[model samples]
Target: MSYYDVDAILTDAQKVPCTFELTVPGLGHLEGNPGAEVKEGTKLELPLWLAQMLAITPAGTKPGMITLDLPDSLSQKVTNALRADPRTVELRSLAPHFFNLGTRMLDLFEEEELSDLLTESFKLRAKELADHAHNPRGALGEGAEFLQGLDENERRLFRATHEGAKAVRAWLVGMQKK
Candidate 1:
């Protein structure tokens, strides 16, 4: 992801659960207790940027300072829902930058199942999105609910698809007139 990407920045700002592995002095401000020590095993929701840094940064011979956990958006419940029916899952409700966040998380954690699930989900959703885009009544009619559930990337795809269809139709009409 590019550093200048607003979506990437927003994804990095999203909070994720983290557990402190070791007690650290004057770090309680993260939990709203300023000037206090952050005790071991203290769990708190931290921005992905900070959490990722802390989780990967080593201290002496030990591995990292904190343990990172999947955000609620990518939890097992959501996974189950996607696996059951990807088209039915409202990805925007889960996370506006769902796919982007998933990509970032995949970099830190090795989850083959999640990777496959996301890929399959995107494939299914994109096909459905394309179908809806090509339909003149899709936006305001039956496919409205599905369109509303699209995440950032999918929305862009839908827009592009819809515009392409419109352009093609306009071209055909001009040809017929000629």
Candidate 2:
């Protein structure tokens, strides 16, 4: 079933679950048009990892914190839905403020179609960062240089990711005020 077709809760109010159709292929579907409303029953593909993420089983999924990497242009209706529902608080830990810098950078690009040049560059740089992180066994600020090349407007949006992280942390902290 698609994300839009997803049943938040089964008849007994249990969390509805579905298995992924494909492993590495992953789920991806359009969210209506960019500037218009999507009719009901619109198909929204759900990736395999997401199915595991929402799965009721463990040892099948990565325990503790996990991040679902998504494209910048993507809009997950289920994320919003789950976020709104009190029963789905388990997801909040992995959802908000997980540092989706990929989407943030793409948003900074403002591209209707991502060019091959930019895509290739990002891949190479990402590999470099990955290698650096792996070798150092510590951390990598490798993205800082490429990120620095972006204009102020882009940096503003990029920084917003960290800001969102801070806000989520603060919100959780304040919730303890109860």
Candidate 3:
């Protein structure tokens, strides 16, 4: 057979443009054939080292994860691992996390993952705000408070957040009683 099917989660995100490390699970193989096409596969794995040039390990205690800082050679291996006909790959992304200063809480609610794309797009929006914040302050002072003052759109977003928070608190209260 030219290829075999397997189910394996990505040990880390493959963020190449920026500076995230590239890492993969130590051992991965198809269920039917363990050592059949390793040579063919290893050939692909070789390129990963190149793709993951400026890699770094995550600071938190998450297990079996790597951050892809630069390009990596092993990305092809990740691609190959998920290359079965009619393929299916389950992906989860641990992108940038923001901390809430008011509550002193960690934010884990914002995330998105697809077969090839995993990111927090809001992070970019948030980053843009952070990057140009001082500029706006200098230009219009109070007038530039977009997300901060949050007109109608921001209020709607806050309402959604409040609903989500209520659900989470309900879950927590239920857990505590049990």
Query: For all the candidates, what are their Cα RMSDs to the real structure?
Result: 1.6, 19.3, 18.2
lDDT of 3: 0.31
Return the lDDT, model 2, position 121.
Answer: 35
TM-score of each: 0.95, 0.23, 0.20
TM-score of 3: 0.20
Which candidate do you rate higher for lDDT, 1 or 3? 1
lDDT of 1 by residue, 23-111 (tens): 99999899899999999999999999999999996456677889999999999999999999999999999889899999999999999
The whole-model C-alpha lDDT of candidate 1 against the native structure comes to: 0.93
Candidate 2 ranges with C-alpha deviation above 4 Å: 1-114, 120-147
Worst 10 residues of 1 by lDDT: 56-65
Poorly placed runs, candidate 3 (over 4 Å): 1-148
lDDT for each residue of candidate 2 in 1-178, tens digit (9 for 90 to 100):
3444322212112211233322321122224345444343333434434433443236565532222233322235533533344222222133322123223324434554433333443344444434433333322364444443432323344456456656778899999998
Candidates' C-alpha lDDT: 0.93, 0.36, 0.31
Scored against the true structure, residue 85 in model 3 reaches a CA lDDT of: 18
